[model samples]
Target: MEVSIIIVSYNCKSFVFECIDSIKKLTELITYEVIVVDNNSSDGIEDDVVIRYPDILFFKNDYNGGFGYANNIGLAHAKGKYVFFLNPDTLLLNNVCQTLYDYLELNNNVAALGCRVYDENLNNQMSYGKFPSVIQYLLEVFPVKWVSDNYKNKISSEGYLTEDLDLDVEFISGADLFVRKSVLDHIGGFDENFFLFFEEVDLCMRIKNAGYQIRITSQAKLIHLMGQTMQVSFQKFKWFEESRYVFLRKYYSKKFIVFSKSIFIFRYLFLWLKYLDKEWHKRAVFIYKLK
Candidate 1:
């Protein structure tokens, strides 16, 4: 197989169908397989998907093992030279699989490649970024508009959100990552400790350390119905924060983690007091519990 497209689905049944349909409609130049690993979703996706698309390989887990763990399961069964880790909430806008596959075939030094991503409205979304740092996190949570805008502009200038040309990058969003299976095997797949966010960032960091390039190309494109797969709630926020800390712990020193946590606690506490918002207060308390 030229590519093994692995999608990890939770409760997003309809989106998964749309995503697979787009892949089937658009991908033609290369041989590929679709592997869907259901993360114990309550929705009856297994029956419907199997009946609708009998050629798809499907597996069901007893419980939701988070994003990385579920994708790791799909990765183990992958039989392609390249593996495409795609989100269920995404739809291809072109022959993205063929474009990325051809790019990798021509550039053997690239460990992973991602394409331009757009929202449902077709506005470009940030699909790649530098490795997370304390300063970047602080800028993200800063309250002042001018400061935040300046930081965003800086990121854009640094090519984190560029869409006009191909560039080497530090991390690619997990929403549409295309990587070689051999590189993944050498790196031991993804770190299962990450339940959701930062898993791909961690993988990219390791890949770069192994002297392979991580890149983004404008040739391929897709639309991501952002945040549709998982509902927004305080519990979801908690999972994000938990994964953030896990990532910090893995890539940073204990002292650095402590300092980062302090900054988080202080920032959230200030926001809670300034806005008198319950959400801010909840986030502050959550960060305190992590200490």
Candidate 2:
């Protein structure tokens, strides 16, 4: 096979149908396989996708394994030269596969490629970003978002301010990361440590560490409904806080982890004081439990 399109799905039923329908057209250009790794979603989605596209490889998990684990499951079944890690909520554009595949064909050094990312309204998103640092995170969440966003986040801002509809990007959204199978074997797929957020950054960084180039193909396009489909059964703040700590310990140095924790402390403090809201206090206490 030339390509294996892997989509890790949770409970989003309609989103899966639309995504597969779009990708279905691309089979003519390149020999491809679509593997839908169902993460044991509460919704009866396995029967839904399989009934429509019976030819698709459906690997249904009995448990709600994290994103990385579910993706690894699909990767194991992949029989393609290139593997596409696509979000379930996005729609592929015409020639999206061919565009990314042809680009990787010429540039053997490219470890991964991503399409130009746009939201549901077709607005350009900040598809590329510097790996999250304390300073960057500060600028993003601070009271002075207007100034920090425009001035400090230049590349991030520039990525959104593209003159051309589609252009090369530094870091593409993991929602649609297209990677070569060889590079995947070398890096051993996404750091299964990351359950959700920053998994792509960690993956791209590892590939760069192994001396490979990652690309954001200008021609490929996809409509991303950003965070609409991602969800957890528990309290949003609680679950995110749990995974945040997990991510920090796995990716950051001990000192960085300490620094990050302090920042989180101060952040919640600032929010609590500023809001003077009881909800803020509860969230602060929740984060403390994380430590």
Candidate 3:
């Protein structure tokens, strides 16, 4: 196969359905295979998607293994030269699969490629940017968001700035990444240590360390329905924080982890007091438990 398209799904049945349908409708020339790893979805997603799309390879996980683990499962079975990791909540505006594939085939140095991403309302989302650092995280959660925004704008994805058609970036959103199987094998897929967030960043770090380039291209486009599968709640926020710490522990220094933890404690406390809300307090305590 030329491409193996892997989508790690949870309980987002309708979103995955729409995503798959868009691929079938738009992709006309790419020789690709779709593998859907159902992460113990309870919404009858298997019945809803697998029955309808029998031609696609579907693996129903026995347990919830988070994003990286599930994608690893799909990767093991992939036979394509390139593997495209896509989110169930994203819809391709065009046959981006073929475009990215051709680019990789042409440029052997480019290990991975991320395309432009927009929301359902056509607002561009930052889908490419620098890897997270201790300094960057500290700035992001500052008291005044304006200060954080200034720093984030430098590292995070700002789709409005389109000066370069082919831009080399530190990392791409896991939502829409096309990567070579050789690079993935060399770096050993994604670090399963990351449960959810920062998994892409960790993978990109390894890819770059191995002397490969990760680039962003404006030649293709897609609509990413951000946060469609997971709802924003104390639990979700906890996982986000948890995975971030895991990422820091793996790549950063011990002193940085200590610094980040201290800041997190103070920030959560400030958030609780600032809002005087029970939810904020719960978030504070949840983070405290990590210590």
> Which ranges in model 1 have alpha carbons more than 4 Å from their true place?
143-162
Clashes of each: 0, 0, 0
Scored by CA lDDT, what does every candidate get?
A: 0.88, 0.77, 0.85
lDDT of 3 by residue, 125-219 (tens): 87887766665666656635556555567755233334438888888888998999988888899888888988998898899999999998888
User: How does residue 173 of candidate 2 score in lDDT?
Assistant: 73
Clashing pairs in 2: none
Write down the TM-score of every candidate.
Answer: 0.94, 0.88, 0.93
**Per-residue lDDT of 1-291 in model 2, one digit per residue for the tens?**
999999998888889888999898654678899999988988898767778998999988999768888999999999999999999998876678878888889988777887777888888865666655676566655647456455675534224534444344445577889999988887798766666666776777777778887767657788888878955434666656666677667667888777766667777778889888777677767766675
TM-score of 2: 0.88
lDDT of 1 at 87: 96
Query: Best to worst by TM-score, what's the order?
Result: 1, 3, 2
Better of 1 and 3 by lDDT: 1
Give all candidate RMSDs, comma-separated.
Answer: 2.0, 2.8, 2.1
- By summed lDDT, the worst window of 10 consecutive residues in model 2 runs over 155-164
**Alpha carbon lDDT at 232, candidate 3:** 86
